[model samples]
Target: MPELPDVEGFRGVMQRCAGGRRVDGVEVRDAGVLRGVTARRLCRELQGRRFAQPWRHGKWLVTPSDGPALVWHFGMTGELLCAAPDDAVEAHDRLLITLDGGRQLRYRDRRKLQGVRLAADEAAVERILADLGPDARGLDLSRFLRLLSGRRGGIKSALTDQSLLAGLGNLLADEILWRARVRPDRSVRGLDDDELRRVHAAMGRVLRSSVRAGRVPARRGWLTGRRDDAEPVCPRCGRPLASGRTAGRRTVWCEHCQR
Candidate 1:
């Protein structure tokens, strides 16, 4: 699934490929990928308008124009691609927006689980995102502590809860907890102030590097890099890594290190 870092990367693609360019045309090859708006209305609303700066929050990408704004949620296997006019279309290219200069922005998703929405105004946009909590990338330590204090569950559940702290998925939650030296199954209320701070700091560090890399980098010495090995071991302590379910998602952690 595309997470926060991946969505941030897609936001950059939108900015580079379509920002400030007039929309020459809109094509919805698969109307099922659209949310709330029909194909005819989408083309009518966006055909001639110029796209403004694109932004992202909690895995959702938005591109506003003079009229309705385009919002995207890249469920499990979705991506936005920038291509030339002559480029061959892929099997999952559901939507295409032709730009003024013949550059194209394509929405491709194999699952088509979540796709696009057309928000009529800023209020509509807010309504669409009202259920999400603070974005993980921009969360400050003070707010982070407060949010954690109010939640009750295993630490992993709190971290991955979109309504509690948006943008973290299974992979990120596991990676952050591993770095913080906190067990995934540890109760949220069981953590002390020092542990909470460490988790917050670790989240910051992980998100910074992940966003820069445009994905969770599976680099050596990082837990993410070793989590999928045949017999995965902790990159830090060289101990065999443990795996199970936390928050109903697959979880990996170093028992010795995290304990």
Candidate 2:
């Protein structure tokens, strides 16, 4: 699944390929990936409008134009790609927006799971984001602690819950917890202040590195790199890693490291 870092990478793609560019055409090769708007309405609303600066919040990417804003939620298999108009469209290229120049922006998705939404204005965009909690990347230590303080669940569950803290997915949650030496099934309330602070700092570090790499890097020293190994072990310690489900998502942690 495309998580926060992946979505941020797509935001960079949007800014580079379509920012401030005039829309020459809108093509909906597969309408199954659209939400709350029909193919005809999408073309009508965005055909001639110029795209403004694109931004991202949590896992959502927003491309604002003269009228409505295009909101993208890349579910499990969705991604945005930049290509030349003459380039061949891939099997999953569901939507394409041709810019004024030679570039074309493609919305490609294999699962077609959460797709696109057309927000009529800034207010509409807010309505779409209202359900989400504060973005994880922008949270400070104080706010991060506060957000976790009120939630009652396993630490991993709180971390991955969009209503509690947006942007973290299964991989990030596991990685952050591992770095903090906190177990996936540890209760939020059971953690001491020091543990919470460690979690907050770990989140910041993980996000910074992931954003720079444009994805959660599977570096040799990182848990993400070894999670799928034949017999995964902790990078910090040689003990074997353990796996289970938390918050309905697969979670991996080091029992010897995380307490």
Highest TM-score model number: 2
For residues 146-223, what per-residue lDDT tens digits would candidate 1 score against the true structure?
898867779998998898878998888888999999999999999999899999999999999999998888997898
TM-score of 2: 0.98
What would the per-residue lDDT of candidate 2 be over residues 1-259, giving only the tens digit for each residue?
Answer: 6899999999999999999999999999999999999999999999889999999989999999998999999998999999999999999999999999889999999999999999999999999999999899979999998788767879998888898879999899999999999999999999999999999999999999999998899997999999999999999998999998888988899999999
Question: Which ten contiguous residues of candidate 1 have the minimum total lDDT?
Answer: 145-154
In lDDT terms, which candidate is top? 2
Local distance difference test, each candidate: 0.92, 0.93
Predictions: Cα RMSD each = 1.0, 0.8
Clashes (backbone N, CA, C under 3 Å), per candidate, total: 0, 0
Query: Please, what is the TM-score per model?
Result: 0.97, 0.98
Q: Could you tell me which residue pairs clash in candidate 2?
A: none
Off by over 4 Å in 1: none
lDDT of 1: 0.92
